[model samples]
Target: MVPEERDGRDHGEERERPRRARRPAPESKRPAPANRRAPAETRRPATTARSAARSAARQLRDLTGHDPESVTSVERQRDGGWLIGVEVLETHRIPDSTDILAEYRVEVDDDGELVSYRRARRYYRGRSEERT
Candidate 1:
């Protein structure tokens, strides 16, 4: 067998191999630095009652498949969330007064995301309630 010569060194010589450069580990494999904290919800707060009402109504419509006709009431809850009353037309009739309407009580978080909702009441459009 013939001897192999590399860099003027015989095959029998003990030469150190050149080290290969290491690449940075992928982002997922690296541990997070101690100074970095997990991200918190950074959504903007719904400041005005009108905006909160709109948000609640939109969210209710998306969930229930009924478009809200009006915002009946808006109240701030003790937990900093909002309680919104929305009116939706459930059924149409020849006479507008005979149309069926439903009131939904929708609760939304401070960030305008709906957390819960329910049909609070239902009645005909022309029906009048006595407030005593």
Candidate 2:
């Protein structure tokens, strides 16, 4: 029994079996050169807040037939867009009230497209209110 168990093979000998050779690393290929310059239209600078505001006002006037009174504020978003607040002196023909002021929120993308618009808030023409 002892002789049978002592056959020449040991755990260490089994562990010494040769490992398979590793494959060589692949070579990186160079990228192909671009065919031609990008179109000139693609090189224009992104639209800014001032430009967007001007364009939005123009569009609003064209669509609503009223010239917005003032641009209260313009904010640039992280995604290269703008939020413009315009104050328009709109007259509400309610029975007792004469004129009412309203604010419109205009959104424009970097390409100067009007993405969205809505009325943010409204207040009396002569009253002052805290900004949210």
Candidate 3:
């Protein structure tokens, strides 16, 4: 009946309608937030050669019970892992330390953990393996 009262009701009605429509759009994006967060794994990307080699060294010390002396080579495997060749001081001797240099084949998963490893070769530290 009153002009002021009519204007207030009209304004109230307009506000309510938009709120109802926009509510669903935001809820749709709620599920999308999970998808957005999934790319976090992708954002990190794969491991680098340096990091893989370091991992190989640390793991070698733990698995082999010997300190890793140095890294010889690093390569990326087709199965989304790293293959690293590590040289460890297996034997510590005086004057001419009889070193057992081993090529440790290392493989790391997506989570940056050592999934698998094995000794590829065992050789002396002072002497280099002659590749023919």
Candidate 4:
């Protein structure tokens, strides 16, 4: 303690000064869990348009006994089913380049089960559908 000068601070008042509050410890910087699931709001359901399209393509190939050429469209129906349009080579000609093509509308359940299907249109491999 400094020698109290005649400036007159009573030594007893120095001991009465307010004590400072202790601060909390800082938060830990540990890494987050590796297996943490995505927030529910940000996650999408397992059944998606692409999967539905694949299911339709598989069903069409299996039913037609030929590999499907392409998936043209996929639509969700009001009945909770899916509607997919597929193109397939229906016939082979002497020249491999000349094949008959058919378009089918396939219906499937949400679980990817085949509900029904029908051929919507037919055309040659070299020609496109004529819009009327």
Leading candidate by lDDT: 1
Residues 65-126 of candidate 2 have per-residue lDDT tens digits of 65688898898876778888887666654542345667888888888788887777776655
Ranking by lDDT: 1, 4, 2, 3
lDDT of 4 by residue, 16-131 (tens): 67999977655644444688866755545445778888998897788879679899898888666789998888887867656787888999887788889999988877666641
Candidate 1 residue runs with Cα over 4 Å from true position = 1-46, 130-132
In TM-score terms, which candidate is top? 1
Give the residue spans of candidate 2 off by over 4 A: 1-45, 92-98, 130-132
Look at candidate 3 and give me any clashing residue pairs. Answer: none
Across 1-132, the per-residue lDDT of candidate 3 in tens digits comes to: 666645444553545344544445565444555445545534444777788888778977888898887898887776677777777776676655355556677777654589888877776656657311
Better of 2 and 3 by TM-score: 3
Off by over 4 Å in 3: 1-44, 130-132
By TM-score, how accurate is candidate 3?
A: 0.59
How high is each candidate's TM-score? 0.62, 0.55, 0.59, 0.60
Q: Of the candidates numbered 1 and 3, which has the greater lDDT value?
A: 1
Better of 1 and 4 by TM-score: 1
Evaluation by TM-score, superior candidate among 3 and 4: 4
Spell out the clash pairs found in candidate 4: none
Model 1 clashing residue pairs (backbone): none
Backbone clashes per model, in order? 0, 0, 0, 0
lDDT score, candidate 4, position 107? 92
Candidate 1, residue 118: lDDT: 93
